[model samples]
Target: MRAISVIVVLAGVLSCRAATPDLRFGWNEVDYVWDSPTQRESAIKSRHFLPEHNLPLGLARWKNKLFVTVPRWKSGVVSSLNYVDIDGAKDQPLKPYPSLKDNYVEDTAKEIPSNSSIVSVFRVFVDACDRLWVMDSGLADILGSPNQITGPSIVIFDLNTDKLLHRYYLKVTDMKEDSFFANIIVDVDNATCDNAFAYIPDLGGYGVVVYSLKQDDSWRVSHHYFHFEPLAGSFNVSGIEFHWTDGVFGLALSEPRENGYRTMFFHAFASTKEFCVSTELLRNYTHIDKNEAFHDFKLLGDRGEGTQASASFYDISTNVLFYTQVNRDGIGCWNSNKPYTPENNPLLFSDAELYEFPNDLKVDDEGTLWLLTDKLPRFVYRSLDSNELNYMIYSIKTKDLIKGTPCEN
Candidate 1:
């Protein structure tokens, strides 16, 4: 009797251990178009199921709520921002943000005051205080025409009130070129009490601009070090991530003319400092030696190689940097090896989790990375077993590299 009991207990223990999850770091899209009546019935039976939106661009998960900002363009019209919810209920559109039409003029009352000028929200973020940060990059008329309108302002909305709080304006015109605010991330606490900084990748200006929440004037605006060479008269910046721990900022450069479509690159800044110039001292403000305060830079690119799509650093855990490489024809991780690059850098993970149309890739507190793919049909999801093969969110554990070890290349 004792031997039989031991065998049963051992079997139970083995079963439990087998159920434990492992980090394979791979995923796939579960094609739901071929679902059967029974499967459809089962999905409907669960209230947690929700419809998926069109191509998703940016993603942010705060607490139990997940926000995805997807931009959709209609012919002869401005793009639209589609917000969605995850976790509690698959992917459901929370709200819709219209695209910005006019941006060149300095008229705030007609633009900011009017709800018609609000463009698609490119990125969504939540501060430590649970305040939602929405970045509306007014508009960029890529196609040359007098009818086209461009926007250069960043509008802040209070999530609790769903009302516009403060508007941060970026003074840039001649939108015919590729110059406009691209991406934004808010750092509420930066050793200087509570503050928020906006990073603007001005492709038209060929540099990165920094703005402070505490500043009310444009004279205080600062431009960081930009050593990038433009390609085909189009050297635009894409994404920006803030590194609070190291006091460094990571900025991504869009593909140059030579590189194929969607190729990506990133640069890092260290020991960043900022100051405000009041309206009274606007004329007294002097540009200081920015290089003296500069420390080091890490370049993630190859003159000729795989494409680097996007990049971002998890604000919660400042250790690792995450970037994306698009694979339309089924290509995998991006390969870049320039001087001062980490040999083991561009750490290639398995393509099992790679999406067909990858955009707006972001990492969360648990090291879990999320991407809004271009292939989400009417709906998408992941089951317990097939979850590993679909859009279901999963936790990831990465081993930190030891001292003096290569992290990228």
Candidate 2:
């Protein structure tokens, strides 16, 4: 009887353990095979290939389309927006249409200063009246002077027509506002107001500036909102993203000094205020020590002094940060200071554990994650899960994607 009781107790404990749910949160590596040779020479010799932008800064997805922006070094501009269509693919490797001639008509480039480059795409929303707002940070002089702008501001693009709608310049009459307005979060679909709100993480401005999207016919600010926190030195707040499920937004902040550390911030707004009252979601998150994690690298300063800079993310129902960096060996991941996973090492594309600097990443409505890789001939596609730990690439149809099926079929 004693032996039986002991066996029954052990069995009950095992059953309870098995019944508990497993929690798996985090990204695994994926590999993709392409019909086109990844060799730059082959692709270039085949067609009128544009320069592969290795510097990925921002990404946006809407209406079954993916938009990616990369810094253009030769042109001294940042209008490298590539559109990918997952709907039409004949072979296993989906062909990429790098030009606007295929689907949408191309428009004239709205040029900024020669040193200006797009840091990231903050928001992509079709307003109730039908307008697309693109918030960006413009540099007066990146290599020359640090912050010499009226200030980096937001630029709006009309989604239906792909035209330059408006540009919002940040300034104050008396003060010299050298704002590093790099990232933003827009609640375009707020329940309360006809006017949408924009939260700008101005690294140099030292706080967030809130703005209303409702504008006059002349493209002027009819009414706006601003929030600044002088005590927290809110200036270093760089990367901003929205996590809908968590009921809050996330901000990746850099240290004030060049040699200082970084943190992950959470901004929760009171629902009653319609997200008006913003407070720190997670203050000063120094989870990873700067020294141990980055000990292998010495900051790059050859052409320009490489500072602690630039970040992107992969939002798999949650936010996972992405950016580029140079390993100790001197290989540059767009020269940004994004973290490198030990399992997903940098500088290779396949087979072995390789890490490609994802300057921008997004998950379309269909649950497919798109990554804009920082390679010589920059690559873009949906990452297919090969197994629990491994990922592969594929170019599939939109119909199949919407149905939650892999395009390989």
**Cα lDDT tens digits for candidate 1, 177-269:** 544345665544424424555454443344445556776433322334332322211211211112211111234322222422211133322
**What lDDT is reached at residue 335 by model 2?**
13
Which prediction has the highest TM-score against the true structure? 1
Tell me how far candidate 1 lies from the true structure as C-alpha RMSD in angstroms. 13.6
lDDT of 2 by residue, 1-409 (tens): 2322333354345435322111111113211122335633443464223233223345555574544443322222223344334452211222222222221111123443322223333333333234445554433224323333233456665656655666666545211244444455444433444455555554443345555556421111101112221222111111211111111222322222233222323221101011122212112112334344333222222112221112322222222232222111111112123223232222211111222332333344454444333321122232223222221122222222222211111
lDDT at 192, model 1: 47
Q: How far is 271's C-alpha from truth in model 1 (Å)?
A: 24
Assess the local accuracy of residue 252 in candidate 2 as a C-alpha lDDT between 0 and 100.
Answer: 29
TM-score of each candidate? Answer: 0.54, 0.41
Off by over 4 Å in 2: 1-54, 72-78, 88-131, 144-151, 163-165, 173-178, 190-193, 215-353, 375-409
